[model samples]
Target: MIRVLVVDDDYHVAHAHALSVGRMEGFVVVGEAHTAVEAERLVAEASPDLLLLDMYLPDVTGLDLVRRLAAAGRVVPDFLLVTAARDIDSVRAAMQLGAFYYLVKPFSVAALREQLESYRMWAERLQGTPERGRHVDQDVVDSLYSLRGAPVRRTTVVRTLQPTMARVLEIVTAAPEPISAAEVAEVLGASRPTAQRYLATLVKKRLLDLELTYGSTGRPEHRYLPRRS
Candidate 1:
């Protein structure tokens, strides 16, 4: 079972989130915290796998708490930011900090359930991966990262990929062998990081396969190719 820690400044809201979690299969709320201090203590005691966090806390902000936990070398669990903060900056910050998903406040039970269920399935896929010499192909990685988007397309219209993303996918699909980020960067005349980010995005979208090849440097390098059947 996946243990979860729910943190919110409002006791009633925290209880509501906890109750929602309790109804889900394979998940249990280890504890609920109303402050950063309490949250940290519960984290140390519970060592939960997922944290449902609110941005506003009596002490430090939720993001700061996560940063502190990570910096302190404590158990840093996957986070789902649930807050009334709806600013674009906060959303971008959450994505930058790698929150699994950001959920707005006053969400319905079904809306919350969709995200939670997606996370549960994603977590299961991650936990199911082999431990030794484990390397995930494009499909597995896609299923992991593409968790939330699939539902959208099914319920509505297909979303279009951004130009750079589309180009990255096209380039990878046209490659004869697994292509490195350096090659893609050269072709696009973009910085290596930009190319790498695009490649990573493509891999996550299940449009490209990521293969690691180690050379004389003794460091593994990721190369991308079209997904194989």
Candidate 2:
């Protein structure tokens, strides 16, 4: 299992994030820290495999903590920045400092789950690759860097969708407002179940939002909206 340490200035937020991490498969929350000093201490004590770090800390910035650990020759685990820092400089610094992923605040659980799942795939790939006398090709390097971006295309849903999913996506994008599965089926000339399946796939890809609407009748109906990039 991947041991995780959550660090945030707010005690409640730190605890909440830790709980969320604990709920994910192959991950466990090992510790929580509310300050940079405490985070450093916990890093040394807990020896976590990953750090869910907040950029704005009570004592010092998370970037400073990362640099300090590096300067002190302390082993710093892989870090995923979970903060509201949107400045280009801060993002560049985090990327240069080697953060595995940067998650903006006010994000949904699905977004965080996607990042964790992507990280899992990356770790698995790294572990499975055979060592070749320490030499690496450009493709291997590129694959590693790609984990920091969007969800990997190797996911089963994406791989199975093929060319048809692209057309389904186009129809969804062309709609002016949130559209229902029945509407999509009519537009694509496909069965409702088929359209619903494609819509669910897009939602899982984080490209669409699924909203529930009550019709004052039976169960709530799901409406799909293209997510703003």
Candidate 3:
């Protein structure tokens, strides 16, 4: 399994993210940290394979932490920034620092899963190659960067979701207001979990928007709406 370290200032949010990571196949949350210092220590101790990092930390910025790790000669794991930072400078810095992916805050489970799966594919390909300095062609290099801007082909996992995704998008778009997964399930004659999976997939594709709705009884629930172009 791919071990993951989740870092965020908020304990609740970090724990929630850890839970989500644990739910994903072939991945497990090995540790959680609320500060850059703690995260750095955990990276060294746990030796996680990946990190889900939040940009704004109590001690240092996530980008600065990346730089610090490099400066310290620590073997840095591949990381995806899970941040609320929306500034262009932040995004540019993350790219320059070699973040595997950037995921804005309040993302769905499917969004994180998509990036994880993409990274898994890239990691598998790299591992399959001989480490004795084999020649890598342009196509192999292009595949390594497939998460950025590659044309979708039938063989890719994302392409396989297109057919059912169309139906999910149709249902979400036709709704007058943000709808819950249970409601969608009832409409589509599917189980709640099945409907939730489809809705999360649509959110990951940017075809739907996910929001939180609070009721008097339980934790806030996710509601989905058609994303405005």
Over the stretch 87-163, how does candidate 3's per-residue lDDT look in tens digits? 99999999998898899988888687778777776676677666766888888777667744233332475443556
Worst 10 residues of 1 by lDDT: 149-158
Residue 187 Cα positional deviation in candidate 1, in Å, after optimal superposition? 58
Off by over 4 Å in 1: 148-229
Off by over 4 Å in 2: 152-229
Pairs that collide in candidate 2 are none
Tens-digit lDDT track of model 1 for 65-167: 9999999998799999999999999999999888989888878887777777778767766877778588888887776788742343321211346778778
Compared with the true structure, what per-residue lDDT tens digits does model 2 show for residues 61-175?
A: 9999999999999998888999999999999999999998899998988788778777776776576566866777889778766766456554433443458776787788899
Measured against the true structure, the TM-scores of the candidates, in listed sequence, are 0.64, 0.66, 0.66
| Model 2 alpha-carbon miss at residue 14, Å | 0.9
Give the Å shift of residue 193 in candidate 3: 25
Cα shift from native, residue 167, model 3 (Å): 26
Compute the lDDT of residue 131 as modeled in candidate 2. 84
